[model samples]
Target: MTPQQYHVIALSSLGGAVAAGISDNDLGAISGYSLLSDNATLHAALWYPGSTSAIDLGTLGGVNSAVEWPNHALGEVVGISQTSQIDPLKEQWSCSYPAGSGFLPYTGQECRGFVSRFNRMRQLGTLGGNNSFATGSNIFGEVVGWAETSKRDPTCVAPQVLGFEAVRWGLEGDAHALPPLGQDPASAATAINDVGSVVGISGLCQNAVGALSAEHIVLWKDGIPHQLPTLGGSAWNTPMMLNDEGAVVGFSDRPGDNNGNNFNGHAFLWTSRNGTTDLGTLAGDAVSYAYSINNRNQIVGQSCTPGCASSRAFLYQHGTMYDLNTLLDSSSAGYSLIFANDISDEGTITGLAVSGAGSILAFRLVPNGGWSGSTMGASREGRSLPFRLRAGSFGRIMPNLTH
Candidate 1:
């Protein structure tokens, strides 16, 4: 009998568009950004199946773009990018930040969500404001994220002026706002299922970035806000993704975090029948985050030490979370799976894995023969210090995509 093993396909990221997300079984197609050769620009990028190089999706007349979420739809990729227009408000919105570098001095340029197809990018317009950000989309060609309005928000801190709300865009780029839970001033639609059920966070306007704005985890069904059961605390209750079966997965802070934004939490799974269950962290770890889940209930995320300072990629299945580094074939000696971002329904996992030398890159774990990742690896792991924090999602403005 042929033995079960993982074929680790390391992805290349040196240079590149539109940002996008959700998991379709597109071989090893990945969505992210790369620092251009000039070292001053960040452009959205895509890695086609079995390709070692990156395909850069140029910006909409601006210098920066990123595909933040993992879109499962192969034909469509949606994300945020900057345009040539300068912001009249002179504000540093969420788009002012990039992944690797710190804040880019509030370029004062307007940013908008974009959809990419066949290597071409089309900008998605904002709702009476200068900025919009796309988080993720389902197979139905529906995009979900945040968009701004014309009115200036009083609750918003300095540097964030226009009021923003959660948004859902159709295939034709028509978008409408999603109401926040109760009287909460702002919200974001992080993920959606094929059936139109959307999951996200609803809270005060805060800084118009993330984190504080995600104080309440909410699921919208048929346009009504149904706040999901929580993992006790309220600060970072973010619903990163949900499967077609209505299973929602993400991170939720416990009661102990002194600073509200500090991500002292555990990965959580919420279902209709079972309610919310805390998926414990890796052995000796202080936190965990479930980024994506498949129809089979397999979950992927990172196990971290306090606010995700140090982390390792993890695959959670059958009531256990295992460090992905332990499952690699012998040739993966120098690689350490630091962030398991998405897992396809077929059990293929993709994420950023840092090397021993500290160069981080993308990787795919494909199950061969008769074995699948759902039933692989025991969770026995000693504390590992090989991985560090993921590059900040928006420079110092925000560290994570949703939160």
Candidate 2:
């Protein structure tokens, strides 16, 4: 099961390499972040098909903003951005992007979910709290993510003073709390399809971030939360994305995983009909995550070695997992696709690539003569690395959170 030859386009970054995602529509617009000239701030940027110029999606006020999920809405982009208001609670909510990541830190500023359309980015208010994150949005302009409630949940770990819950922002940008699983204190919605179904996590409010905040992976249909099956063990059950057809994909811990203390899980595909199927790591790789799944059933994400210390991008199709690097056109033989971020329904893929000399860059792979695209190639980087898969990336994507 080999993929068709694909030419690569290395999307221009601000000053250095960054992560990116391709839109799920035919336009192929791309959303990613960039290091500004000051090198102290990062802003979300958008790229039109075949264009090298990056349009910086201005921030709300604070220094950082990023688009992690491949938003599916046409003419709309949803993501997390720090606002000028300082968080009274002084918590580093999920909006925080740790240092060393191309983006700047959240700096304890209040953050919010932002919807960008018609050249304006409007902040989505929280549920009576200082922070809210926007991860998914549908064509109807409804957004999904998580927002903090005023409650100082005892369930939260230190520095995480408030309780949070999955949120669905209405067309008018109103935030509505989505119920968590039975007695759960936290939840975060990662993706929403055009049909309005959502997939996310429901669990203990450990840090207002993902780690302890993700327990029971959930699917919301008609606003009712349904617990999605796990890969045996509990903890780390995260639903990163869902397709219009109700297919969900993400990573989860396997049985005997010490309750996710050991992130010993593999990528999984879940459908109402088939339950849950672990996509298993790339041969010896011990960790895998399926970040995006298209209606066509193609899945893309990263697989990492034990401890997730090393990584490689992978494409799973037809019941087989293949390292994306092996399916590239000759022109891109010099680079290794390190993180498979998103795959459009048309089969176009966007992710990060590294050269032999340690240079990293964002890339988009377009199938030969299949649709709109352009290419930039580098000579084989001192001979391709041996064909093998174990672990995968520098960014360490955690679904919607840059953390």
Per-residue accuracy of model 2 over 1-403 as CA lDDT, tens digit each: 4456677787777663444543445568777666565545667877777876778888898778877677877888888788888888888777663323212355778888898886478889888888888888777888999999988899987778899999999988878888898989788898999999989999998866555577798998898999999887677788888888999998887877786666677899998899999999776677788888988999998887765556778889899888776667777666777777788888888876766554555678887853222532221211122221112122254222222
Q: What is the C-alpha local distance difference test score of each model?
A: 0.72, 0.75
Q: Tens digit of lDDT per residue, candidate 1, span 196-224?
A: 99998888676676566778899999878
What's model 2's TM-score?
0.89
How accurate locally is residue 386 in candidate 1, as Cα lDDT from 0 to 100? 28
Residue 61, candidate 1: alpha-carbon lDDT = 81
Task: Give the total clashing residue pairs for model 1.
Answer: 17
Q: What is the model-wide C-alpha lDDT for candidate 1?
A: 0.72
State the weakest 10-residue window (summed lDDT) of model 2: 381-390
lDDT of 1 at 109: 84
Candidate 1 displacement at residue 316 in angstroms = 0.4
